[model samples]
Target: MKKLIMSKTLIFLFVFSFINVFIKFFGGSNTLIGVTVVTAMLMFLERDLTIEPIKNTFKLLGINVFLGVLSFLAVQNIGLGVVANFTALFVVGYLFTYDLKRPMYIAFGLQYLFMVGSPVSANEFPVRLLSLAFGALCIMIPQFLVNKNKLEKSSKKIFISTSEDILTKIRNIKENKNIEEINLKIENNINSLKKMLYDNRKDEFYLNDSAIDILNMGLSLERISLILDNYYDKKMNNNASDLNNKNQEICLDIMESEIKKLKLYIEKEELIEYDINLDEIEDINLCEFYIVLNNIHDYFDEYKKRKNTKSEKLYTGNLQIPSNFKISNIHMRGLSKESIRFSYAIKVALAGAISGFIMDYFNLSEGRWIMFTIFSVIQPYSENCIIKSKKRIQGTLVGGTMIFILFSIIKDPSARGIIIVLAGYLGSYTTDYRDSMIFNTMSAIGSAAMIGSVSILFINRILFVLLGIAIGLVVNKFILPYDIKKGYKYLVDMYERVNLEMIEEINLCIKSKHNNYKMKNLLLVPGLIEDRMSLMGINDKEQKHFIKEQKHLTSSIYNLYVNIATNKIKDNDFNEMLKESNCISECEEVKDVIIDSIKNTEDIGTKVACKNLLQILNSLNNKEQKITV
Candidate 1:
């Protein structure tokens, strides 16, 4: 409840209302309108009200708004309106189309362009932009007054929490417990940590390097746990011998001790040396128990080195704006299917055009309401459209009823003003609460009712909202509807980019002379692949296989980092293997060969796994061969 009141959204509403009321008192409607223009423009520019400034906010706003006004003027040409609007949508779509990057400002511009029945008068554009720039400054003022270092501090806590969770899981494994629940918890923490890393980077905080190290460490720990789990399962087999039991106990003891040392090292922020003796452990080859132990040892050794290393200052630079914005990244997606942005742009433009035509033909008053409704309610997915449709209806009903009742009793100007203020507060406070749209709508209509003709406005608003929703539904269903395949393909395209970036970061970090070279592209390939697979469902065998290979590749990348950290890659044999390449079918083949070699007490299994790991590294670095796909 307390957090709700302090939330930036609520604060923004308060500031807007306070400024609007103040301006209304001094300069009346002209000033109030100017303030509204500024507030609305700035609010749209700010997608999430984080302290970080938008990338090229001023530049993007200038270009988009200028183009929007031009487009709006073209739309006033009776015969050319639909064609102009359609052309504007495609142009905006193409201009902003970067692979995996959504340009929300383009959408914002379209909304502004179609805001009224005609283009805002030529003279009003400059005044409105000046007001908007002032509003943007006002919004940023509070950001400076308050300390936003909480993001940095909280992110560090999240990173620490992730490490603690992993340690708990390892300790639980020692008690012979079911680790599935703990595994889920660790996964959740890791995801939260990833979000923090991105958030910190977005804020341009100095803790980015530390966050990356923590994330990498957490992933390495997870890989180590998997190794332990596999070894534990093999040792606990029904055909297990006394030799397996002895070896299992020794490995468990070694792991438990090393994990304790790791926890100590993390907590104290100091180095801790540890060693495991495979020569001392009897029958090390009986179950390949030594291999898992060796990996864990390498991980711990690497963790210590990475933790002690003081990283160089990360690159903190201003965002760049391209001189030309016409390039389309859709072709880079390497898909025959049209990009979703292109498809969605067409859907929105077509639906909006049809709505405008219907309104113009009927000679409806305030036809701008129809365009606003279509812009607000139409969505990328059918399910989203349905949900938004329900919300719109509920909001309209609440707003209309509130206005009707308020206008009947409130005749005194001063009394109505008080009511408006109170209603605004209630609406703003509950905007994020249950029936948020309803409260927001109620506030808007109720405020208008206090000063203007309520009955007509109420009826028009509700009618247009319903009409827009209906048109949006028809267009989405009959036009290019939601295509999960296309969405999956797009996600895969994004994953490929992320994968390449992650590998490149690792490559740079390894080669850099700087002791503290932070990895810039920390892509969560596993999570991304999971999302893609979920969209494709169980029927996509090729995507499934690709996801599996990618997971192995990601794990191998981390494990190779661990190997490099431990100086294991310095070994002549390992160095030679890292330089070689093999066309491996899958990680499973390598795993199978490893298991067979272990059963036969041969080095082939270990060699196969090492070769496969190197192959993934090579594939990622050399995009010419591109994962043999």
Candidate 2:
């Protein structure tokens, strides 16, 4: 939290506030209101969805500007305006979902919806469009610059924090806390680390060897944590008396020392070396503990050596972080009915269109609120959509009522600005939908109040919000409804198909020179599965185990394929050379092949690839069962 306050989010937020204040000081508070509200909405979109905010900001603004013009023209004719709203919402929704893997506007697509909401008035159109551009620039430019150096910052934070968490949980077990609960929290953190690393797989091309070392470091920590969790689960529950009086103390001491060393590394980038002689511990109960500490020591020592030996990709000519947005592949993966991505787009388009038609025909004041609600409330799945809709109503009722009272008491504009800022921030910091919406409603309504009657705006905003959520819910349930279980199965089928194709491609690439195409589903499918599993919230032990294992297995196969292809070991005679290694035998597992190859291979690159491949495949073979909740 301390680190958060001093960094990018804070810095850009300051810039955003300053720019909005400047706009407000010059009688653009209406524009200021628009700017602030839209920026808040865009915050969810860009921050959650895209890594390249600076680039994405430009791309999105260009689309918004074009559509803003079209919306202005369409609004001149009421009939055309309804159609335009539907078409704009539908097209943007569908095109963005074209890439199934999110930041698929998972949280908000309000920025685009806001663009097409303007009426036929020429005056309002430019203000809305210009405010959006100004609002986005104020935030995204600083965000891009501040985050430019933070490419590996999140991964490193996760790595260091989760490592500390594991050590802390180990200590907590000694405190006689609920061992199961401690272990579950540790597992969730571990999953967070994996999700962050995997979600950014494509961006990894920009990561240097050192940055990747941080990611690998996190994975290693997860492995060590898993070992501890499994060991403790059995030992703490079954051999409680035996452990408490025996190796637990010794192991705890070792873990405490490692925790200190881990902190030093996070602070100074210093590596650790375990001073303990594991041979002397001699305690049967703590054997795994000693082994893990030894592995951590080895990892740091190797990390130190590689830090010196490997060229930093950041400085290397081979590093090719694209300066422009890469065109995402636009091919449809399946029928609209089967895909969650398409279902979401279709539901959003229909809801927005139907609601827009109703609002326009009636010439409803703040009619866009209904469209916005529909867009925001209608999630990919129905259950979540239902909850979000309820929260949207609950938040608006509670927050709108409170803000109305406060704004009535204080006629001071500056006071309202203060309320706006505080409410906006409170919303951002909140995690729960209802809780954040309380603050978000306060902020949003407060912003709208700057230009209109608080009473009229409040009442209409409340009415439109309620109306919108209703339309959204109806559309989501009836219009191409999505099933979480079915979605998981679709992704499972995709994973099977994509992995086979990937392996085949690896085989083909090695056999031929045609290695140019690799399926994007290789990464996307597993990620989608992860997202679905998270949404489904599966609690059954066996089901979780199978899903986790499936993910690991696919990841392992992908890793092996990547290693072989990356090393360009197409012509390398690891198979034949393996027969000469005295330890080599016929393949019982994939690791056997890598083991044999690494044994005989003298080429540094092939040996490295083989060794890394060995580590990856070991994940599948590891006796320690990884824990998740």
Candidate 3:
């Protein structure tokens, strides 16, 4: 109770109420009412205070204003208004995030619908715009003033925890214990670390480049995991000569010692010195490990250099708007159909039109809530809709019950307003929490009560919300229902295609005697695959297996690219060697198999391609060893 009272949410709520009071007492125009709604809507989007709240608040405010004006201009009829809403929703969904839960316009989109439904004359648009701008500044200025010291402290905590987890996973691999489980655990930790980096990037006020360094370090750790997997494979499958065995032991010890030193430096806040020698390794796999180990050392060296010049104050008050507004950039890749985005845009438009029609037919008051609930419950995938709808129904029932009890007991309007504001403040903090539906539903009920314009009939509100959910289900499932299985298959094919492209690029790099191509697509494949898998809700075991296999193939090819880049293959007949070894034919074979599988929707091609690709990798590794020797 005390923590809730002292939370930053309470600060926001106080500012909100204070602004409303100011506008009301000063006889602010009806436009100010628009400002109040816009400001309140923006407050719902304020999920993480760890980020640059002021910067994001301003950027989102700009987007809302843009959409609001567009929605206003395009409200000629229901058809055009739906078109405007669809365009706005699609653009926001694409540019803002691929994550459904964090749709950049989740609140703003609903507001646009409300504006469309309740038309304002063109003469008043600018005043409402200015009013919105003013309200956004008022809300964001206080957030900027409250500099939470915990931001930097939390960053350090994440750094230490991530570093510790990495070292422990390395230790586990060395012991050959719970190899699969440990690798999955490490991957999860790395993902958490990456998400932290993304979250911190939003905090432009306290932007730190060290997080970038940490992310690079994490990638190096993943590369190390690949090296370890290859090492284990070689050790298990092939018999090493006595000298090679002794050399492998020496290399492993040196690598482990360096990792321990890196952990100590990160945990103790000390400068690091590089102490690994990579010049004398006989094993090709160990040489690859040595290269990544040196990369990790370089990260620490760079960190030490920047540590001396680390800024004193984390908050700088410098903020830039996000610039992800390019429509051409949002290709329909991995979405199975080119028309998927179009389908979703139309679904939202139809839902809005249908919702408006229903409201008009029934003479419903507070119909905006019905439209809001429709979009809130409906998702691109039917499975997501079903899950969300169930939660929404459960939440609405409980919230409506609570509201009924509260209003039944409390008769004073002022007292009910204060309680509603307090409850809304508590709900604001839990918008993204696990039980967010319940909290948000309760908050909605409280808000409706405070407005007190319509009758406070809890049953009517619940029924209206249920009507919206039913409409959403019918729209999402029966009308152009999304094929999740097909989407998953498309992702599978895309991952393979990208991998093949990287290989072909590497082949060209060797043939052209240049390494200008950086294989950026190779780096993105794992993340893209992971994102799709998460949306589809694949198990950890499946995700790990796929990533492990894909990582192995990419790591092998990347090492070969690095070797060629470093002029290690210049004196050798690289093209002639590749021809004689049948590497190209093997690659072509894998490509053909993948194409067949994608065409037939069969896993046989994937299985064959993975096997052939691994063989090609092992063949390349042997060739590298012979050339280097």
Judging by lDDT against the true structure, name the best candidate: 2
What lDDT does model 3 reach?
A: 0.57
lDDT of 3 by residue, 510-578 (tens): 565332312532443455466556768766676556656666566555545544444443222222444
lDDT, candidate 2, 47-153, per-residue tens: 32245465567865676566666566656667786677666666666656632345345322565555456343565556766755565455455554544434355
Q: Candidate 1's residue-wise lDDT over 69-134, tens digit each?
A: 545555465556677565565555444443333345334434444433544556655644554455
C-alpha lDDT values of all predictions = 0.53, 0.59, 0.57
> Candidate 2: deviation at residue 163, Å?
3.5
Which candidate achieves the best TM-score against the true structure? 3
Please report how far candidate 2 places residue 39 from its true position, in Å: 3.0
For model 2, the stretches where C-alpha displacement exceeds 4 angstroms are: 1-54, 95-108, 115-130, 152-157, 166-207, 227-311, 314-327, 395-466, 488-532, 551-629
Show the colliding residue pairs in model 2.
none
RMSD of each: 7.6, 7.7, 9.0
Q: Using lDDT as the measure, what is the rank order of every candidate, best first?
A: 2, 3, 1
